[model samples]
Target: MLQYQTIPVTPFQQNCSLVWCDQTRSAAVIDPGGDLPRILAEVKRLDLKLEQIWLTHAHIDHAGGTAELARQLSLPIIGPHKGDQFWIDGLAQQGKMFGFPHAEVFTPTRWLVDGDTVTIGNSTLQVRHCPGHTPGHVVFYSAEAKRAFVGDVLFAGSIGRTDFPQGDHDALIASIRERLWPMGSDTVFVPGHGPESTFGRERRSNPYVADGV
Candidate 1:
């Protein structure tokens, strides 16, 4: 079975997941917003090799500490290409605007596309491009685990805000309904923030989904 642990990092409380295969001890770090020390500690505690760092989107809170973590672990960074390249390139500016102590932009070693698969050890995480919160937003789905790491595109009882630059309300809504909802009703959703939820639960209870449904 695949083992998963979530470390809530940075001021945004982004959920950074450390997923590993028990047999191979190979792991992927998902959305390392910050707290490099804690991430490293978990890697050590789990006795796993950090193979790659994956980003759900390029927002400051999601990609801010990627550079430092990659440098320390010497792991490749991977992310979808559709979202805010401008935001990824100008992370420092976004950090300054938000009053963060420091922020640095780190280019991904690989740009993900729809249908791409990220493999670590015995598992594969399929990339689903669900653009709405940001133009290039994506979710990582592990079919075997019946889980999806949905970035800012979704939340517990709500969806991501579309007030940011390049954010589109209609597009966001459509993406969630078309791309995410079809994943499976029982898939567990590990969002960018807040508590975990299921696609089935969100589809029925989320106001955004209710409006769309």
Candidate 2:
């Protein structure tokens, strides 16, 4: 079975997830934004054999600690597609702007695409390029677990801000309608900065992309 725990990091309280295969005890940390001590403590408590670092996007709040964390863990960093390279390059500037710790730019060990697959232990996750919140934003979905880790895309009741660089409101909506909806209504998703919710719940009540709203 696959298990995950959400560790809220940074002042933004972004959801950094530790997803692992229970059988193998192999794990990956998704979006280690900040609060490295807290994140590391959690990993220690879980006794998880950390393998790689996964990212959904490159926002300061979602990726601020990625470079440092990867360095400490000596783990591979992956994802967010290559389109987010600009954001990655501006990590230092983004940190200064956001009053966060000095963040360093980095290159992922592997750049993800729409159809990429990520393996953790014996579990595999499908990657969907759901650009909008950011040009290279991606969502990690596990069909076997009926769960997805979505960053700055669809929120509990509201959607991501499309005012940032390369944000596209139309593309966000289409990604939700075309790419995410097909994953099934029962799919539970963990967003970057809020509580988790099911596609069914969001589709029925989300003001931004509700099926009826």
Candidate 3:
């Protein structure tokens, strides 16, 4: 099984997850936004060797700290697909607009697509390109743990915002219903912000994408 910790980082309180394998002690930090110090501290506290960084999307609040963390640890960054390249390229502008400093842009070592798998130690996460939030958003799902790190995708009682550039509300809904719903209702998901929820609960009560909504 994969062991994980969720660290809410940035002024936005984006959930930065530290997922590792119990057997290997190797880990991957997912979506390090602004609070690099806290993230590094937690890594040390858990005694995990940083292997790589994984991103769900390139939104400023979710990916702002990726560059610095990657540089400091010499770990490769992966995911968010290639379509969100525009957002990655505009990291500086996003920082300026959001008043977040050091939103440096860096290329991903691997651009994920649907049906790809990412490994961390002995555990592996299946990648699903669930765009609409950013046109390239991906959700990391671990079958063994029945947990998903769904950044800015489906929330407890809401869904991701689709007002940003390249965002599609219809696409977002479809991704949630088709890609996420099939993961099984008991699967617990970690959103970019806010508390985690089960896929079943959201399917039943989420106003935006509920079965009866």
Candidate 4:
């Protein structure tokens, strides 16, 4: 079975998930926003062999601790290929723009693309290129687990802001409806922030998904 734990990090309380296979103890870290100590602690407690660090997107709150943690764990940083290269390169500047403390950037070892498969332990997470929140935003879906790690795309009762430099409201809506909604209403959705929700719940209640009033 695939087991998982979420560690909320940074001032934004971004959800950093540590997912592992019970049989092999091989693990992957998703969205290590910050709180390096806590993430390391969880890895130690779970006795997991960290193999990869996955970022849902390049936003500071989502990818903040990536460089540090990847360096410390000697793990590869993996992300989708569609996000703004400028945003990834200018992480420090992005932080300053948001009044956040300066942070450094880490080049990803692997650039994910749509339909790419990221292997962890005995399972594989399919990459869905669901842009909108950012130019290269994506969600990692595990067919075996029936769960998706949707980063800042669709939140509980609400949705991600589309005012960021490369954000697009129409595109985000299209991505969610076409790519995410098709995952089926029952799929468990692990968002970047806030509580866990199911695709069905959001589909029925999310204002963005609701039919025109």
Candidate 5:
């Protein structure tokens, strides 16, 4: 079975998730935005072997600690998408602008594309290309767990802002209605910030992408 714990990190309160395979006790950190000590402490407390760093996007608030974390653990970095290469490259600038710790840029061990799958131990999650907030944003869906880790893509009552360098409001809406809706309304999502919510609730209540809107 797949199990996860969400840790809020950085001043932005980005939700960094620690997902692991209960059977193997192997783990992966998704979106280590910052505060390495807190993240590492949780990993230690759980007594799980950290295998990799998974990214949903390269935004500073979502990927600020990726480089340092990967280097320290010698773990491979994965996901987000090749489209976010530029964002990854500008980690330093983004950190400075956001008043975050200096973030170093590093190449992903594997750049994900739509339909690709990522694993943490025996658990596998399907990846969906969900660009809107960023040109390369992606979502991780675990069908078995009925859970999705959607970074800055959709929120509890709002949607991702398409005001960044390559943000597209139309594309964001399309990605939500087309790509996300198909995942089923029962699927619970962990957003980049704030509390978790199910697609069913968001579909009915989210002002920006609700069913009628």
Candidate 6:
């Protein structure tokens, strides 16, 4: 079975996730956006082997600690698509602007695209390129867990801000309606910030992208 824990990090309070397969105890940390001590402590407490670092996008709040974490653990980095290369390159500048710790930029070991799958121990997760918030933005979906880690795409009652460089409001909406909605309303999603919400609930109540909107 696959299980995950969310740890909010950085001033942005990005929802960094620690996902692991219980049977094999293999784990991966998704979006280590600072607060490395806290993230590492949790991994230590769980006694799981942390093998990979997965990213959803390259925003400072979502990927601030990626390079450092990967170097420290000798772990491979994956996902977030190649479209986010520029954002990844600007990590240092982003950190300075955001008043975050010095963030180092690094290349992903595997750049993900729609339909790619990532594995952890005996469990596997489907990856989807649901851009808009950022051109390279992606989401991780665990079929068995019925959960989606959707970065800054869609929130509980709101959606991601498309005001940043390369952000596209129309594209975001289309990604939600076309790519995410098909995942089933029952699948709960963990956003980049705030609380988690189900697609069904968001579809019914989200002011921005409700069914009728």
Clashes of 3: 0
**Shift in Å, residue 175, candidate 3:** 0.3
Q: Give per-candidate clash totals.
A: 2, 0, 0, 3, 0, 0
Clash count (model 5, backbone only): 0
Query: What's the alpha carbon RMSD for model 6?
Result: 1.1
Model 4 lDDT, full chain set: 0.85
In order, what lDDT does every prediction score? Answer: 0.86, 0.93, 0.93, 0.85, 0.94, 0.95
Residues 35-68, candidate 5: write the lDDT tens digits.
9999999999999999999999999988999989
TM-score of each: 0.95, 0.98, 0.98, 0.95, 0.98, 0.98
- What TM-score does candidate 1 reach? 0.95
RMSD in angstroms, all models?
A: 1.5, 1.0, 1.0, 1.8, 1.0, 1.1
Model 6 lDDT per residue over 1-213, tens place: 999999999988899999999999999999999999999999999998999999999999999999999999999999799999999999999988989999998999999999999999999999999889999999999989999999999999999989999999999999999989899999999999999999999999999899942
Model 2 regions more than 4 Å off: none
Name the weakest run of 10 consecutive residues (lDDT summed) in model 5: 204-213
Instruction: Rank the models by lDDT, top first.
Output: 6, 5, 3, 2, 1, 4
Model 1 is weakest, by summed lDDT over 10 consecutive residues, at 204-213
lDDT per residue, candidate 4, 1-213, as tens digits? 677898898889888899888889999999887788999899999899999998889888888788888888799988856465667898898788776666788788988888898888887788988888888887899887888999899988888889989899999999888888878888898888899998888877888875321
Question: Per-residue lDDT of 1-213 in model 2, one digit per residue for the tens?
Answer: 779999999999999999999999999999999998998898899999999999999999999999998888798999989989999999999999989999989889999999899999999999999999999999999999999999988989988899999999999999899888899999999998889999889989998899952
Candidate 1, pairs of clashing residues:
82-136, 83-136
Candidate 1, superposed: residue stretches over 4 Å from native: 211-213
In model 6, where do residues sit more than 4 Å from their true spots? none
Candidate 1 residue-wise lDDT, 1-213, digit = tens = 567898998888889999887779899999887788888999899889889898888887788888888887799999956456887888898888887658777778998888898888998888988887888888899888999999899999999989998889999899888888888889998999999999888877887786433
